[model samples]
Target: MSELYDLTIVGGGPAGLYAAFYAGMRDMKVKLIEGKEVLGGFLHHYAEKTIWDVGGIPPLRCEQLIERLSAQARTFDPTILLGRRVDTLERLERGAYRLRTDDGQSHDTRTILVAVGRGITEMTKLDIRGADRYELTNLHYTVQNPESYRGKRVLISGGGNSAVDWANELVGIAREVIVVHRRPEFGAMERSVARMLEMADVRTPYVLRELHGSGDAIRAVTIGHADDEEEGTGIERIDVDAVVVSHGYTRSYGDLLAWGLEIGQHGVRVSDQTATNLPGIFAAGDCATYANKVKLIAGAFTDAVLAVNSAMRHIDAEAPGMAYVSSHNEKFREMNKRLKRPL
Candidate 1:
């Protein structure tokens, strides 16, 4: 017989991970499935980065926050499946749910939590002329590791926050940091913009027109005006070692809707109590869209608690629907001690 869990939380970001932890607190059998190579979701990309908000927690680095959250999740010891995408979902006659992955793996669970944030998608690639030849080797859409370009000449494209942020991050590390933005004004944070102005190597009002390089590596990039219509004009070339493109991302919802799961624009539409349209199913996190939207990480934690509590109540019919409130001070005391910060 195939083992079945009481709850299956998809998307191991803040939502899914927190949901898994909360489900465990309710003494429910939990399975967490994440589509990424590792846990932490988007926050993983900026691991070393600092975060100001997250309830009572002090300004913590992204990696520290992820580590703390992961530790909390492990307290319950969930059946975690990393680097696996849940491609399909279907309800069975016995009131159970079936989940299928891209690799033909399947699992059965009683309740479902769809927490796939921003859908599962990759960023758009730089399709410059002759750029495809050395894409994998020399060019990248996302900065997987900034340290990889240390002491090397790097050219980054795009005017968005990510592109500018990378330029700021790679300033001291890379040999020369060149940013090519199509518009005269950058679309990043003011602090980043101000910092970028200090680095004169970054070029504005310029667009990357073409890429020229040989096998396995990029040598230089062709730039032109943002107003140029047909091809490149006022074309200037700059030599570089690597090119990183940070245009934007493309969202992919996998096949949740195709597999009979209800998905809304904000994510999975649920009630004030986190109950979804489907019976025995709930959702939380960036993917969930309740009547009132709470997209913050702290909000996801609260929603997960509510959803798991509600799911447990549904499983145990005799259980009362009283609001979950802790009157005791022990919980807060313990939280303070463990987190090393006041609750």
Candidate 2:
């Protein structure tokens, strides 16, 4: 237990970090809470991937963008508590909040902003029998390091952005790269698809049938045509040194279900201002849902701003609608002064 904060944000993803910065700009005593040891959320999982979607960034790596975001977030001096899972949230008197984490640490705050994007995530597994046995050895889910598969035969399963990205990446690293998907088309960018096929063997309109290997190691895989109506299409066995499945992930809401907030299909239902049904509690990023909501990193930034503004209003009725832009903001100038160490 420590000093009560004006804002205690949950989840330290891109949205959370931005909200913390904005809250600090408003001169509120805020703390950013995170369940994972790492600060960047889902983006950290795809650190190796090149990101071209974020505005004003030209094809930067995910990890590089995270580093920039981390630098910006720390500039605000928001109290950061990592590796702490918020188990429960209690609504205290007069719109304040009390949160208890798994490690028995408690925190109190006047406002709460949930920026948990997609919650805790686990990779979708290949359903083929015994395919999971080789997870640690050959069959892989998340690509931690691309260099590990250097010059080895690789097979990637899935047609999403990750599948196409890995196919493009491993083309230079792996001896041979192959991608298998059940659908006829890929759910990736058109330019990425074009480049990936130039170097990788893509087996779409197909499905993984079996894994051909001995104990704890994969030598090859058996794949079959996805369409049964197409006659004379037999199963094909492709040799590979490693198998990477990128069928997306399974997301769990974690302890959010116990919070007694209004949960919806996409996430917690939020107002136009990003406020939840509960007073002084707000949600942003993928964990919050509103009409015509955008889900990109850029969109999450917009949502975070809205939530922070709503939180400020809730915290103090006389609070202004928004803070001044960074260039003209005195706070930013003051923060810049802090950047230079004392002589």
Candidate 3:
């Protein structure tokens, strides 16, 4: 009995944002629900990272692109509901869908789009005490702006791709870059790991043990050998202005498995049209999977289009396969009025 919407897009990531924009372009009444306090999904986890794969987008920071997506998504002003998690989705007797959230609110929609990527994930924090206090000043799980560390000594913890990648990028900006990892062998790009080894102080098989700081700022850290092979080998103190923990994230299915959708090891099973086997339901972005699927932001853009267009068709069989992009003058006219011209 809730307000009925033409489409209820779940997950406010890139795919959901883009899908909302397109549905609005089609002049459909749409609502965008996001579980996180903010819009952009895991991208927030790497806000400072540069993305180069998105087509025609000049290399820009993750937050920069997220801002662009946020702007583009507002072209038609879809109702954006942030910090609301869709816990379960059920089909109404009349074929419309009803989605219930953890907050005890429900929404009625003509169609649905599942764009939640990898469900909800939280960054793994550094296991050092007093590290939490420095989070506001010197500690960061995701680097929102790389320039913030300019000319300051920085230490990155973790041996994965994110850790090494951040080290590689910060080498030029920070006064000093040091990478501390529990494993000597790194699981990062060979080129990046090689470059970091050459330019940054790469520590091997070391785990963080202590925080040497005062008030809200961290000025140094104590590192220890990670393995019993070198138990009590030694501990070292390194001076640093900031610590970036790229320990990655822990992912779970959450409510997706209980939704009764066909999910696989890769992601939700989706058809060529971005439609799920369930009628009136579709999916896109990293949450949906199919043959020859490209797992990139660029691909997510296409998925949004496909899912929206397919949903449009589901709503009205007479609708075109897709409203032509860059050709529909009528659509572009209104969009252009609100669109920020490239600088």
For each candidate in the order shown, give its overall lDDT on alpha carbons. 0.80, 0.87, 0.86
lDDT of 2: 0.87
Which run of 10 residues does model 2 get worst, by summed lDDT? 334-343
Candidate 3 TM-score to native: 0.91
Alpha carbon lDDT at 154, candidate 1: 92
Provide TM-scores for the models. 0.81, 0.78, 0.91
Candidate 2 lDDT over residue span 116-223, tens digit each: 888866678999877767987998887878999999999999999989988898898899998989998899999999999888988878888888887779988888
lDDT of 1: 0.80
Instruction: Give one digit per residue, the lDDT tens place, for model 1 in 82-198.
Output: 878898776776788889987789989888887787766667777666666786787877676789989999998888888888889899999989888888788889999889879
Backbone clashes in model 3, listed as residue pairs: none
Per-residue lDDT value at 51 in model 3: 89
Q: Give me the candidate number with maximum TM-score.
A: 3
Residue-level lDDT of model 3, residues 138-180, one tens digit each, is 8888777789989999989998888887888888999999888
Candidate 2: the clashing residue pairs are none
